[model samples]
Target chain A: MERCRELVRPALVEAVGRLHPWTGEMAAYALGWADTAGNPDPGGSEGKGVRQALTVLGAEAVGADGRDAVPGAVAVELVHTFSLLHDDIMDADTLRRQRPAVWKAYGTGPAVLAGDALLAQAVTVLAEAPNPRAAAAVRHLCRTLNALVSGQAQDLRFEHRPWNGPGAVGPEQYRSMAEHKTGALLGSAIALGAILGGAPDETVTALERAGRHLGLAFQAVDDILGIWGDPAVTGKPTHGDLRQRKKTYPILTALADSGRAAHELAALLDSPQRIDGEAAGRAAALVEEAGGRAATRDEARRHLDTAHRTLRDVPLTRTAAQELDTLFTHLLDRTW
Target chain B: MERCRELVRPALVEAVGRLHPWTGEMAAYALGWADTAGNPDPGGSEGKGVRQALTVLGAEAVGADGRDAVPGAVAVELVHTFSLLHDDIMDADTLRRQRPAVWKAYGTGPAVLAGDALLAQAVTVLAEAPNPRAAAAVRHLCRTLNALVSGQAQDLRFEHRPWNGPGAVGPEQYRSMAEHKTGALLGSAIALGAILGGAPDETVTALERAGRHLGLAFQAVDDILGIWGDPAVTGKPTHGDLRQRKKTYPILTALADSGRAAHELAALLDSPQRIDGEAAGRAAALVEEAGGRAATRDEARRHLDTAHRTLRDVPLTRTAAQELDTLFTHLLDRTW
Candidate 1:
């Protein structure tokens, strides 16, 4: 991972820098560089740079040269950054990575433009690759990009009120949103690597599907941590999900259970900001007591199992499979 | 012109309706239909819709099936609407087309989302075209779309303060900004027409260049009217540009020529609101005295000439070329 990180950062910077010549400053800010003043401010500043790493790792795992994957690395990172910029604006959270969000910092006018530049450049840069295969990647990327935005719109709509009319968000609905928001991009990341490598179509599909499963597990874990993770570790406020009243899987499970704990959770949700420290602690305990936490864990584990199975079944070399295995397992096994 | 408007309005509405699966409220609002609350409170509101008409006309000029250009028409209109939504927000303009702007009516968040949705659906709908040609349209439209945003950024940046520094914004900078702000999409409108009509590359290039020039002429005439036209005639405020203090070509030209009038003009520009109606009238007279309006007209005429030249060069029936010539001439010939 460290080796991959070192290889991809400069390229990520180059790609983002080359993105919007007019709006490039906003793109730079998207990468956690500055606040348009060129001041070195840290606000969880650097992205995990995980998407670029995913591209390179996907390439290496498929027995393709890492150098061949550079374009794909740049492409994936551009999509990822654009998604973050736009989503931050749509969510209206005002803070991203603990910094004033782009929309908040420069105002929504420029933040949206900055995000627009990223998406436009992603296609432009991909078109630069002299491979006919690049067209397929571009096509798939556009579809995924559209899905990402659609999912976000749907998710934002969910926040306006209790969706499905007074019931917890169902697990299937959670999966659908996760698929569009997180898994679609992840699948595109893996698919990009395979197509750039000239891997067979079947293997490409498997890797993409594996990525989807991994993304689902990743988000499920994220949801669990959103409610219960320590701020010291998560860098997010305690009960941040409760604060937003986000309908993550665990909370949904608790709400749908229709028991004493469920009733208490509903009461907490009805009164915005009513979930105080003790109330939050009690709510978390009730959620776990009502099997919500366990249910979420089981769903995540199921997806992780599917990802591993797909990785094994994908018709790639043993080494390729092993690299993917390493990445997915580590993603699922994160403790904080 | 009535026939063109008839062809464009319903088609534009239907295309935008396919975008978010939501009701046609935003599109309707933009189209000057129902109000923000979905009431049928419409008597006035309509943009030039010139971009959409151009797409259809460009296709017709090729003697190709006009329906083939529908995706391009929809895509360009949506991109144009997105720009209007964001532009109104950035400009802090309260109204558009004698009605509330999208941001004003829908609130900032939904207006932004609506714009984002429009843009996303623009790409998605283009991608959905039944041929690879539609994909190419997507490719060109995305680039055009980016440039549009960049242009808006430049326009917004310039709005923050005066361009009191060096260089005559000249024909070149104005041309560049106009091309990005409006021309590229018009060019896309034409090129996509040629593509959808299966016109050859040379013809497409000619159409595109023609569209660029037409766009410049369009904006120049707009800038001219923004200041000089009667409010009753133009259906906008007289000296609107002066009120906006827009550093358009005429103003820039006036500013570039040094004199007492130029100094007074600059003073009025520095504090546009402080300038009385008499002072504003004096400023416009001084701008004319400084050869501002004449220089702008000359530039507009130059572009119109180039646009006609490109139209003549393209391999088409003389009648089709003449039709385009008439359209360009009418656009440049707008009185108010």
Candidate 2:
């Protein structure tokens, strides 16, 4: 996967430059660099680029040399960027990757527009691709973004209206939300790669299923790391999700499976980042005590198993598929 | 234009249905319908399909039967929907065409997703349009959205941080912002029609220029109405833009050129949506007193003249082009 990024980075940056040109410099800045005033800055965009990695790996695994996959990679990454930009605004977060979030540094306006620009750029690049496969990939990319937003909207609604009431929301609600928020994009990323590579329909579906579970496991792991992992490694504050009162899998589990401790933890919820450190710690402790942490970890492993299982069913090149499988498993190893 | 709507409405409805199917039902309400939440009540989405009309008109003026312009019709409308969705959040607007705005009803998260969904659907629709020219139209569509957002970001910034401290924005700033915010998309709409119809590159450029001026004229007329139009005709309260403290051409002129009245208005300048009714009337009076309203009207006339000149420069089928020219003039002929 790391090797995949080295292959994709230069193209990614170039495509990004075209995505938001100088006249729209504020949008470019809002995307990943610069402050609201459009001053250039480094370190604004930093993610694993896992979706892009999937695109390259899928294309290569199917013998496309990844040239055809460039559009797929760019389209997938752009969609992800769109989500991140808008999500930051939607969630009202003040930070991303330890820097001022695009919305926070630039503004809600540019931050939102940057996301739109990226999405629009994705379509442009995909449409201009010489291959017929590009059209299918673009269509898939659009649908993926559409579904992801639906999932995100549901997640947002859960916070205010909840599934039932205060202390409501069960595992199914969390599952659906996570599926849309994380799984849909991941599935689309892999599927697009297959589309670019012209993989058989059955194989493409299998790869999508594989990515979907990986995304779910991947999200559960992220949820755990958001609470229990080392902040130095995760690059996010300890219990950041907890403090936000995010209805994450672990929190939802404790609230559903445990009684008294769940009530006590629920009592501590506040307006996300506005919550005090003490309440955050107390909430984290209660999650562990209620066995929610162990349950979430177990669920993540199960999802990973399901992901690997789906890969075995696909008709793929042995050597290429093996590399992709390896990449898939490593996605959640979390030890860096 | 009514004929255009007859063909495009079903598809637009379906495109919007993709907008956060779960939570975005609220946004659906804001677009023109009501939902079961007993909120997000009905309004109107009943605009003449001017964008697609231009596309079709462009096709007819050339030779293509307008089929190539269909995707662009949807694309332009989707961009409009996306802009409205975000503007509701940025401006903290409460209603759209007389119903609760998407953000007001759905919350920012779902509202944002609704916009995203529309963009994706628009892209997907363009991808299916069966011609490379349609694909090029897709490119035009995306570029327009990017520019629109840039202008929107600058507009928001103007309210919070003025470009030149304590003074009116220069005419160039207004033109720049207006071009990006208004002209870009409309220009794309016109250019797309020409391109889709296989017009010569020269003709496309000419039509794009015509559209740009038409766009500016359209916006100026809108701004004029925003200040002085009857509420019933415009479907908004008179001077609602003033109440929002939007720095339109008329107000900026008065503030830049007038004396005592400008001082009084400037005191309420930084505030948004805080001034209404008599204050709104007073603001209008100041613009008129300082002759700014007359100047703005003249500027709008100049834009219309430029549009007419460009239209005259282009090759056009006599009847179709003549009708289009008439439509062009009639856009600014409202009583307001």
Could you tell me the lDDT of residue B33 within candidate 1?
64
lDDT of 1 by residue, A1-336 (tens): 667667866766776666445478777777777666755656436776666667776777778876666777787888888878877876777877777778888888778778777877776676566666776766677677667766776676667657235444676777798888998888878888888888878877888898898888899899889988878777788877876678888888877786887777777777656677777787788778767899889888999999899888766766656877887888877663
Error of 2 at A69 (Å): 3.0
Clashing pairs in 1: A61-A320
lDDT of 1 by residue, B72-147 (tens): 8777877777778877877788878777788777677667667766776677667676766765676677678777
Candidate 2 chain A lDDT trough over 10 residues, lowest sum: A19-28
lDDT of 2 by residue, B1-336 (tens): 877666666776776665666544654564565553634444455456677677677767776666667767777777777788877777777877766777776667667777777777777777667776765666667677667866776676667546235555866678778888888877887787788788888888888888888888888788888888899988788887787777788777777764776666666665544676888888788777766678778888999999989888888887768867887887778874
lDDT of 2 at B106: 65
Docking outcome class, model 1: acceptable
* lDDT of the candidates, in the order given: 0.75, 0.75
Q: Candidate 2, which CAPRI tier? A: acceptable
Query: For all candidates, what are the clash counts?
Result: 1, 0
**Ten residues in a row with the worst lDDT in model 1 chain A?**
A160-169
